[model samples]
Target: MTDIQLNMDGEPGWEPFDAPALVGASLRFVSGDRTGNRFRMRYFRNASGELVARVWFGPETEGPPGHAHGGSIAAVLDEVLGLAAWAAGYPIVVGNLNIHFRHLLPLQTVVQVDSEVVAAAGRKISVRGRIVLGDRIFAEADCLCITLPEEQRRQLG
Candidate 1:
């Protein structure tokens, strides 16, 4: 196995005292040894400690002619919501995610996924997220997350 930093790799103090330590060891930026194009997620934890991710649609991810794929949109939304919830000290797996596509989102346009936790009921957490193209709302999503033990979640963090 190759060695990588558990922190931001030379960027000082990204892991604050208040934030739960992320155990991913390292985050992936590129697909290994792939020939054609592939999707890559850009992420950052916002001021509210929410994990936000964005991706520009690829040609293969077309749903209608040049429009972006609905399935891709849903997957991004789910990923964002799940990360946001986990960053809030509760590492969980996405159980169910419901997405509503309101418009034909275009390809090559950057789509932003913003997510936040709405509620928590025992082992289940309710998360809501929105996919936006600049000021326009492209889709809305809600998710139910099942709490995972820290030991289990930390392994893949």
Candidate 2:
């Protein structure tokens, strides 16, 4: 394991991301799980204008000894990728999530999640993302999201 410094605050080339009012209030499953209490996510836009998140996997996310649980990693990917779609002007709900875990993420370390909107066709939006620590990749995901009906979206808000 390489020694990596964790910075909770915003770093250079990244700006803080404020979740839209409704999404911030309605998000409760993974991003706001009280029992899991596994992550602290700070959203940002990198210099190139891609969606990014800095996430800290806390102690409660442990699964394999000192590493973060697979579920935790998946949750982060789900939310960040969905948000990436939203940032790209799509109103969506994740229809399917496919994640590949490459390495065990150490607990209490801050990792970067970089996301991009890849495609859009009718109601479907495709987004790709990854969780990385310096040069190491912990996980990567491809998400398929379905745009919500305008009426249903209003109901969510």
Q: List per-prediction Cα lDDT, in the order shown.
A: 0.66, 0.84
Clashes of 2: 0
Clashing pairs in 2: none
lDDT of 1 by residue, 34-83 (tens): 22233445566665666665555667668899888788677667666776
Q: Estimate each model's TM-score.
A: 0.72, 0.88
Summarize candidate 2's per-residue lDDT along 1-157 as a digit string, tens digits: 2223246556788877875552766566555643345777777888888889888888988999999999989988998999988888888999999999999999988899999999999999999999998999999999999999999988776
Worst lDDT run of 10 residues, candidate 2, spans 1-10
Give the Å error, residue 127, model 1: 0.8
List pairs with backbone clashes in candidate 1.
24-157
Tell me model 1's lDDT, rounded to 2 decimals: 0.66
lDDT of 2: 0.84
